[model samples]
Target chain A: MHKLYMGNRQKAPGQQFITPSSHSVQFYEDPEVFLEQLAGFAGAAVGAGGCYLVLATAEHRCSLQQRLARRAIDLRMAAAGNRFIALDAREVLTTFMVEGWPNRERFFASLEPQLLRARSARLRPDAPLSAFGEMVALLWEDGHREAAVHLEQLWNELLGRHSFSLLCAYPIACFAHDSRDDLFARVCREHTEVMPTEGYTALQSDAERLRLVSTLQQEAAVVRAVVEERERAIAQRRHAEEKLWRSEEFVRRIIESGVDCVMILDPQGRLEYISPSGQQALEISNLSNFLGRSWVEFWKDEDRPRVEAALAAARAGGIGSFQGDCSTPQGTRKFWDERITPVRGNDGQVEQLIAVARDLTELRQAQQIAVQAEKLAAAGRMAATIAHEINNPLEAVTNFIYLARTTPDMPEEAARHLEVADRELTRVAQIAQKTLGFYRDTSKDKWLHVRELVEDVLLIYERKMRNKQITAEVSVDPELRIYFKQGELRQVLSNLLVNAIDACASGGRIWLRAHASTDWSEGGEDGVRFTIADNGAGMSPEVQKRIFVPFFTTKANVGTGIGLWVSKSLLEQHGGSLRFRSRQGSPSGTVMSFFVPGNANLQVHELPRSA
Target chain B: MAFLSRLLAARAPAREAFPSFSDGPPVSAVRRPHVLVVDDETLIADSVAAILNRNGYDAVARYSGLAAIEYLEKKRPDIVVTDVMLPDLDGVHVALTVRKVLPQTRVVLFSGHVSTTQLLELNSAAANSFELLSKPVHPAQLLKALQPAD
Candidate 1:
């Protein structure tokens, strides 16, 4: 049978006797049994006149005192004689621990003197010293397994240096929930001896001791199973924490890198969190510059009411939106479209609002530009319709003038006044046409004899001329054909002829003549030149010089102020020119002449005059 | 040349009549031939009527077909001169109405739009029922068309 390694030796000094110099660990299920075992080991050493030190939990200390007194061992006397020492394991741990780990310097500095004195005290000359510590077990029970093992190694060193027998104990219930093979093996290797709580004491029979040892071994197997389950649970928790951290990191990156501002506001509309991009979008250096401020204050004064209303809606757990201009820290005003959504708490009450503000300044400007362009296009369209509408009134006015002129036996001055009025009224038609499209007149061009066009103008003014008994004569060959925009040149000719007729006095004569001219000094090209000569009035040099200027009209209420200027422009466009010669005297007359250049591009290349 | 002399000879009385058509002194009580002028434009209709009045025709101006129909209820005129595009029931319909009611009321359809005149001409049957004149028709052309071929 194996002898129990109890620390109750009586080895005499200077004798060749073997002493217990190994440490032990005891596992106990019942507190009473642990106390009894502790008392048995320490009390036996004291009875043999040896010293035994005990560092244990307070409950164990009190239980040991009771059991020791029950066994008739006088603790007070043993303490007085320095044969036994008891300490609270937690208090001693603080004295040796430095920043949650047992420090060698602190442990030695605090307890080395006491340990030396305990070893040196020889209550009996032949006695041996022993101690039982529960500090390592206290650390292991609190989940500081590594620290507990380190402390066990420290205890083994102390035992080696002090020649004392060492014993340690942990509650069996602690290891039942956690059994680590590596930790158990490391602790056992650090100690010189390890044993069950009951194995350290002298029991009656070998069979009884074997049964208790077998029971301890069965408890160890159950502890190993628990430790395996604990390891699996720890690994899963680690993996889940890593995944959660990665997801949080991904969300942070998205918000930080976005161009828009993302913010969170409390239910009361106070700003809470501003994303990294939010500060950049706002052009603020720190998020604190915006956080804790009323969210509505971010908007301009005119838009504050809208922001406040949106916040109120969001607070009620509803979605809300606002768009308006606000000045940014960059010193520019920008339009932002903000969408706010309520975030609910677990109890389904609105806890916060999530706001995403997108900068829409450029988009709004582009839309405004597009609207202006559309308005301009619409105005262009309206001009054409307006021209058509104005023509109706113009036609009526022209008819009214015709009626007034045909009223017959009118006075000479009245007849002359009506002629100027008729000339100016034609200017209104030109303006209406130009407003619709300046190019509208040139759309239809045709070749016509100058004499035919002159006759047509004569027919138009026949009633006006005859009302004043004015004589008009046309002298042109039937072959004076001109390639031109028939309507535009006709208008030009009509304007000149009307001016000529307006210049003629009552019973005055006006002549309309056309001939082909080749005057090289006058930009001579082979083109038809038409002349209109009136024998009534002639302008002075000053009047002639400014006549081509726009809005220069001699007849105040009657002149169009644009007729001569428009006529000159039309003549220039057709590679033609309007030249005049006038003399102010008796039989004074002004002869206005227009030359149409020989046709180049203007000559129609189509099949001519299909018979 | 003969049409010119005939129109001038017919209009010789207006040359001697006075200062203006509207402000002229009162003339003989022999009520000349009555004419009705219909145009959406008030000025055009009234001015045309005044012109006819000066030319010895007693003319009335109506701005719409309804007004012309009302005027026709009291008297059937020698002619009905209506703008082709009136505010209510354009000239063709007005001409049809006038002809249906007063078979002797000669209808003249005048329009400033060439397309309207052409469209009317395309309907040869409808064209034959009325005399067509394009605006701005001179008072002489209107008087000549109204003349009994002298």
Candidate 2:
């Protein structure tokens, strides 16, 4: 039987059983919690059985016996331990307490065989824990005069079988059968009175036996059912959560595939999540470091305030946006379109701020190119009209000269008049020719002297500048040689001077300075810089930003607005850049700087020496 | 006293009489040579007047063909020098008008911008009494065109 029960612990088959005089039983939905309740109940049963015999007088013995008998009958009726505890009347007397002789000798004798049998019965069929616990408790209560020794041994056995020390509390389960008139109550009053000391401490052995036993079983059953249901619910919830995770991952992948940067920000303006596209657009490696960092940190310091304002406004409303240059580790990037939208919670408070920034730098550059082409087309039309209009009058004058010179018998005074007429016609023709030659490439690969270019440009403005009483100071390095179309250089210089004159208020000084740069890395020592400065009302930064844009002019009627645009285009084509410094409403005026690289290497191959 | 009497009775030179002829009646049977000087610009007309005076032709300048017709009805001109761009009508119309009103008149039409094809079409009329010339006209061209061939 011991081997069989040991086998049960290892993998015992059903059908093995034991016959016992009495048993205790419990039912539960969970095996573990029920085991705890069984241990507690068994502990009370030990104390209850021992105290019943020790305290029993003749007046209480009959009632106690009847109660024990009734309880045993109820255990059988409940079929509680029937599967693990066998029912046999003759063997029941030996196993249960047969209280007959004094000094408890007969009861001890009757229980000796059962005590030995209980030792082996501990190894009975692989019974449910409640039945096994009941068998152990009965053997403890009725086995011998040294029942206390057997109880300890039984406790050691059960504890050795179950790892949790809480199960060793089974012998303490003797408190279960305590009653006022019963012998166990008297014994509890003597030996187990240590129970009624404090709240839970008062739950010691026999004193609170009824409360402990009933509460233990009831709670165990209830907790077992609750645990099973909770586990089922948790499993179902995990399945639903996995499904949601896959869908969110799909959406994240789609967002990453797009070219536009998409990001989610929390209410604190920190980056909560950024799509892969956002990382690529912003040129960042890891999104983890970006998380919980302020979104404004990604923008330039000057742009942060505006970005924050835009975010705040968007969060307050449904939609808003801002435009600015964002400085990243990659480079300073210009973004034309940034859309911000707020995700609101049920309380109408913004929960998150979602932003999509589409790179508009390419689009803006394309638009600028198109506008430049259109402006050039319009300029071509105007040039054609002016050319046609001026040429007709010039041709008429030329033809009239031919006819006048050919007429015979013309007087000396008439010849002199014809000469004067021819001179005036020549002046008109020059104007027509100059107007037609505006910005045209007529003179190419010319090594024009810087002095000559300056002198020619100044000649156009000499009379006007003098009339305005504006002094001119020009310095050109006589030795500096530049290879370019002389006519184009003249046009660029003329336009610049004209613009400077127009921008300057009356009585303001204009400075035209040209010199070789001291820095060799910019080019050889031959690199020339032309700085044109004036004392007049300067333009604002906003004006400076759009100054090079086609058709953007401050002087409406007097300016076609193509002068600066053309100058810039020409300068860029020549591998140069134009930079200007200005402050609005200040007399400091504007200083425009132009850099021309004098590649002596170019002169070696292209320049023809006249000397 | 005899020299002053001689200066008052003697005939003025043709150049001195040129400025006064278009201002009033014809000095002789030529009917003041009611010249129709055509130009689109006002400055060119003023300049042309100075040239015409250095010569001996009686000239009246109008900026458009319509204005020339109005001036002609009041005073029939013996010649016309008109520009191609008039405010209402062109120099061709002025030429056609001069041919109709004064059949013996000569017309010199000037323009700086007309295409060769347009010029040919305008000069196609043999009875048009006109010759085409491009602008920036010299004073000699005006004198030569105005000189009567013997």
Classified by CAPRI criteria, candidate 2 counts as incorrect
Model 1 alpha-carbon drift over 4 Å, by segment: A1-20, A123-125, A141-145, A176-184, A197-420, A423-430, A433-611, B1-150
Clashes of 2: 33
Sliding window of 10 residues with minimal summed lDDT for model 1 chain A: A9-18
Q: Indicate the docking level reached by candidate 1.
A: incorrect
TM-score of chain A of each: 0.43, 0.43
Which runs of model 2 end up more than 4 angstroms from their true locations? A1-369, A381-396, A402-421, A442-452, A455-474, A477-480, A485-491, A505-526, A535-552, A560-566, A569-574, A581-590, A601-611, B1-150
Cα deviation of A133 in candidate 1 (Å)?
1.7
lDDT of 1 by residue, A1-611 (tens): 22344433232322211264767676666777677766877777777777777788898888898888988899899887777788898999999898779999888776677676666664765676877888998999888888999998887777667677777887767665443356777776776555545444555567876886788789868876877788899999999999999999898898888988899989888999988777776777866667798888778899999998888888887888999887877776788999999999899999889999998977886676467557646876676457557767876777667666765676788878877886677655544544343223355556776677777677667777998788998888765667778767777887898888888889888898887665475565667778889997799998989888655788889885667777888889877888899888986999998887757423322323222
State how far residue A350 of model 2 sits from its true place (Å). Answer: 18
Return the clash pairs for model 1, or none: none
Top TM-score model: 2
Superpose all Cα atoms of candidate 2 onto the true structure and report the RMSD in Å to 1 decimal. Answer: 20.0
Give a tens-digit lDDT track for model 2, residues B23-71: 6666554434456677767556644643463345566667767778888
Across B1-150, the per-residue lDDT of candidate 1 in tens digits comes to 453333223343433322244555455534577889999897788777777776777788889988888888898898899988877777887887887899877888887553464567565655455678755565556778887654
- After TM-score superposition, the amount by which residue A603's alpha carbon in candidate 1 deviates from its true location, in angstroms, is 43
